[model samples]
Target: MDSTATGMRTHEIFIDGVRQVFHVAGTGPVCVAHSGGPGIAWEYLRVPSLEQRLTMVYLEPVGTGNSGRLDDPRDYRLDAYARFLHGVVEHLGAEKVFLLGHSHGGFVAQRYALDHPDRVAGLILFATSPVTGEEFWNSAMAEVARFPERHPGRPEAAGMPDAFQEALAAGTDEDYTTALRRILPLYFADYWAHEELAPMRAGLLAWIDPMRGEEPAPFDVRDALASIAIPTLAITGAHDFICGPRWSRMLHEGIPGSRLIVLPGSGHMCHLEEPEAFTLAVADFTRASVPGAR
Candidate 1:
């Protein structure tokens, strides 16, 4: 497969009789990237820094991106998605991969590593948590309150917790875009500074999810994390509304020998707001995790 600086090849594979699509960019060892959203497109997790250094297999996820959607919505459950992730590695004929998962995708990645510890060379987790449920919504409420009272969407931001689901239920591009705009302030440490443009761009590319993580009720993976034998790096923003530095700390502590990095004055969108720092953190982790590094 010929890949230029900007060229990529999209490939399709069948898992449980359903066709799933993923993109391949660069060469050398594989680092499979699972985008957040659970249903959002893969573009959000696109890290240009890691693309060429390590061939990244950009997973579109089971029901998002160029991948095929599932008929039985229950299949969207986290465990099922984790199973799909395992299948992807086999489909690619790789023995092991350095995995990157953000937000919901982080949940799936952890589940995969928990179930198949030997298959992962190392893990790079961003803006994710061991437990996700009502607490996620509650913490989000507190975080949004920090925003200025005069912010454009302050009044409507009360419903930001439900905005993603509302947009999902509505299933209209316009509604999705509006919900994306309304809830934009909640995701940034300093919303007015970045303004609506960033979240709006993300929302336009994002999609819907049939099963929210809150479903089947909240569950925590901290107990199982102790058994993971891979070097893991957890990255989070100090101001991340949903999964703040504390959550990242918990992730680091639960996984034996894991490292955590926090980006100051950033929120959920730090990958966008602090791209250079975020990218370099992952790059450093990858290099340092190697057998020898000075």
Candidate 2:
């Protein structure tokens, strides 16, 4: 598999009446993974090194990005999503594929791995959590609090959680875009000083529009974690406001044979903040778990 810029192929696949857009890069054992939100497209997560090491299959779930939208919101549940992913892997004729997920995507991946452990070769969970509890939400908001002091809209944004939720519930593209623009910076405050995150920032806003008014369903994968026997890598950024190190620690403790890696001075988007370190960690973990690799 070659992860070089010129060797990738992008295409769309239809399953159960939904079209999923994906990019295939390199040529080796397959690694089929999705992005977070249950609505976010995979475009924002492009790991070139992983693509080079394995035939990376980045899938945009149904109703996201270039994929076809579904009329029923019931189809958005984690169980349905995991079944859809299984069909995708089987459709691709991959008997043993690696699974890597980021943020909310990791939640999806966790469920899928537990449901079909025999089909999975390995698991990579980057800045993901099994569940979003009150403590986690409060901690995330506290992280957001740090920036209000220097941020331009500090006064207006302070204690504006109701306003933010109202904007999201407005169910208009413009409303979603406005709220995302105002809130996204808090997720990456630690890395804003040195890195250019314009692409991720823009993509996130675009991805949030269709998801407006769609409540995030509760996901409890604690029991599933114990059932996951495959080697797993759990990576988190120390400063992650979205899903913090505590989430990663919980995953590491619950999932058997899982290792945890926390990158210093990084946030939710650790891959972007510390690409070199992130890539190296993934490459080492993947190689170690690949079938027949010593």
Candidate 3:
């Protein structure tokens, strides 16, 4: 567990009486990681490989994990999330930091970077997109539809149409994770191959009391991408049903000089499918992007 790791303290701040918490772990250059799910625990994105090289700061997004919940669903908007994160970063006393956002976290990351590009030294967007509307979801569903063509005999994907929605409506966190497990086979190119370690890792994740918040607001930041001048890297799994290569290309192309990497034979969980590669890619980008970080 590396309890001895430097700066392993968990810090907290109050936002409208709800405590927003962040855990600092490992050592060396600091890279703040925002997990996906918008409602997930930050521990879900823990990359031990990146932790080996960089001090990973895991931010518990508002209304999730140890963070406080909001009574208004509108408070779940990107701007509000960005403001909360900015407050956390300021509390850390860091002049600049590398930012990593995964899936839903990517939404908040883009928002934070747009609102405070100067505070960001580099950006890592993984398994994410610039927008989440009818088109984005349709594209993902289409990918799931083609799963049988690539993975013959995996008929469970047929029910994926209702998988996410059921999970959302399931309410309880345990029910949500259980529902997600059903669609997880669609998230990895070789699910059984990594199932042993992956499930163990999931068990290690930390969750807070039931998350109380409104449905996440739709995101649209394609035009705003032009203003993000920091070094940016967008990586996605080729088979990522949710945030696939199309959006990865959008970020790579929209952000000037931004680089994109597509992992073959993988799905939404590319970091777990190929952790070593994921780790190195991030290490390489942060080194080149952040001054003196190399």
Candidate 4:
């Protein structure tokens, strides 16, 4: 493992023949977490404050970031992803670790907790949905429609879904990369425009290669949420049109003892759009769940 300038130690670990890279930093109880997209890397979700207080394990899901591709696209289901997370925690020898997931990653974290509640110390879900229903997709499309007028060269934002589907059907590496770069801004209008993290974007684009030839596992967690008894935190951004406050509200209501925090003016990528508020919310919840973590 090698250390980064930000005081984090990074390592490459393998699970089920798929290579995964993770960055571990700070002290205290472990916080095993991953990013969204079902394929997005951890780079976009990096938060310095969370790392300062907890041993944050930022994971790169198989076929994403520095992680190696899985030979079988069938290995990318939610159940498999949950097992992969469990393996990572076991690999680190952490008896109980706080779990955090953003966007789609929240779905993965929640499922893992349900399958192995004993392994988790706490749960943190950000801008996630309970189920992938028609209402959710319609709401997401509405949000995408509002961006074209404001974003230059994206006069056809409303047609993103069809365009995306077409690209997936016959896209080369460069084509997929272009599609991702185009769609990413819709997730976080502010960060994509302002954050100077060019490498992160490039890495995300590169990660798309493994993401292809795989379908996103259908998201369903009603039964799973009933099994989760750990202290949980659900965060949403008021402006997040993709997975709006309604989604987080459903999660908070369904999960027993879960607290909900909705940040104002923030969108899908709430952590990046409003880092201070996001960190404070997560930090406060972490302190409450873990003994002496404050």
Candidate 5:
């Protein structure tokens, strides 16, 4: 399977009996992108400009899109996602590929690189953190609390907290989807000002079970981040309430010699909020990290 096999298309491959679905677009170096939410549809992570610089593999992720779901919903953890990602990379026949993960997807990327360094040419930890425990939750809520201060009298500001709580408490797919739309604007630096993104908000889909699954331990890989020797880039939107600069900086500090880029004008969804700047950073990093890739 050479690079040409990646020509704008959608491919499906079975991994451990589970069908994994992914879409291929653009040309150049192969870069596999995993969207956030553990449950969010992968479509939102697509960046057409970046596709111009690299062959983008947008994974639908098992249990999310056309892919198969696990019999036990609790099995939807980082390790499972990483395994499916590895299968996609192997099926592509790319000896080495750049892995880009956004938000929760970033967590999957980090776990993959740390577990399989030889298979990865570089890493892009976009709008994600290395840990997710009490500290992480507290810091995120703190940021949410400040939303009203930034927006002043905006009516949406009043419901932001409740919206976030609803997101966490969402018991069904429909409940989660509703909660997501209500807080979708909060993911952008200035979503209301960008009416063009309304359709994205309207079409969002997610699963409530994955997020509510039981974890043997709180997700924390800070101590192991230093072991990742491949060229790495950690980027996020400055205004990102959850995985903002503080979290990205920890990624930078923990991953030795990694590059950090904070898009000041964006929020959690930096790629959508600032595609040009996001593309430039990712494009340059991939070109430099994987020599002769283009």
Candidate 6:
């Protein structure tokens, strides 16, 4: 962390009586990053390469990390997260800041940008979709079924089926974390080939807030995507089984003037799997999209 800029610091603010925690590092134009999971820890989404060129604020979204949780887990929804994100951006003192969201985080980002377009300088929707229904679930399931064929001879491949089921049924923090570790390989284009990601898998942390019998409202933003007027970039990995090109293309086509980038050799975790390319795409987009950004 460079001392000349925001450097490295953890800041906490109270949003509607709930504690909101965020980590700031690197320098240059501010780009607030929201991690996915609606439950996974925020650390997994940190992009060191992009951080070098932009002041990165990694948000520990409500119900995750040191941030305060909602009394009713059912209150955890995209609109709610987007509101909390707005509070964080306001607290950062930036009238407008570039926003980057990954996976579930991308959903929140879309909602936020749509709800508060004036406060956003630019939007980066990475590895996310515009809708979630039978079509989305079916596509992912079909890909999950092919995991074994993709990683032939790997013993862990056999456990993916069970891992996917466990992840869905996980009700406790420990179980959720364990399930995430088991299914994490599926998020990468070639996890076995890259041993560097092992530490991340081992250190993975998550919290599960079950809806308690109630299902979340089906996520569908296709009809409303055209309303987003901010500069947008929809990037994803070609190999990302979940939220791959098929979904990113929809985001690109829906958001008028939005750019798209598909990392050819990566998967869901494009930032980590293809750091150099990922950093370049995001950093360049930030500079081009945000006026007066360093």
Q: Per-residue alpha-carbon lDDT of model 6 for 1-294, expressed as tens digits?
A: 133453568888999999999999888888999998768899889887887888999999888889998987778777778889999998989889999999888988988888889989899999999888789989998999898899898999988977898898887888889889989999989899889999999999988755521236678889999988899999999999889999999999999999999999999999889999999999889888766756
Per-model TM values vs. the true structure: 0.87, 0.85, 0.88, 0.86, 0.95, 0.95
Encode model 4's per-residue lDDT on 36-135: one tens digit a residue.
7765557778787788888899888777767777787666667777877887898889889999988878878887888898999999988888888667
User: Compared with the true structure, what per-residue lDDT tens digits does model 5 show for residues 68-105?
Assistant: 99988778888898999999999999989999999889
Candidate 1 lDDT, 1-294, residue by residue in tens: 344656788788888887788889876668898887656668766777777577888888887766778898776788878877888898888888889888888998898898888899889888989887677667766665545453555565456556645654656545655666566666676666765456546555555676644457676788898898899999988888887888889999998899999999678877777878887888788877766643
Model 2 lDDT on a 0 to 1 scale: 0.73
Estimate every model's Cα lDDT from 0 to 1: 0.77, 0.73, 0.78, 0.76, 0.88, 0.88
List where candidate 1 sits over 4 angstroms from the true fold: 1-5, 149-174, 191-203, 292-294
- Candidate 4 has an lDDT of 0.76
lDDT of 3 by residue, 1-294 (tens): 234555467888886576888888777778888887757667667787787888888888887766777776556766777788888888778888888999888888898998899898889999999887888878776876676677666566557656856755776667766766666677777676674656644554333224332235557889888888889999999878888899999999999999999989678878888888888888998888766755
**Runs with alpha carbons beyond 4 Å of true place in candidate 5:** 1-7, 211-214, 292-294
Instruction: Locate the minimum summed-lDDT window of 10 residues in model 2.
Output: 206-215
TM-score of 5: 0.95
Better of 3 and 5 by TM-score: 5
| Segments of candidate 2 deviating more than 4 angstroms | 1-6, 149-167, 203-217
lDDT of 2 by residue, 148-266 (tens): 55455546445445554554465655665566655655556353465477666665643442433133655677766887889999998987877878999999999888999999967
RMSD of each: 3.2, 3.6, 3.1, 3.1, 2.7, 2.4
Report the error of model 1 at residue 254, Å. Answer: 1.0
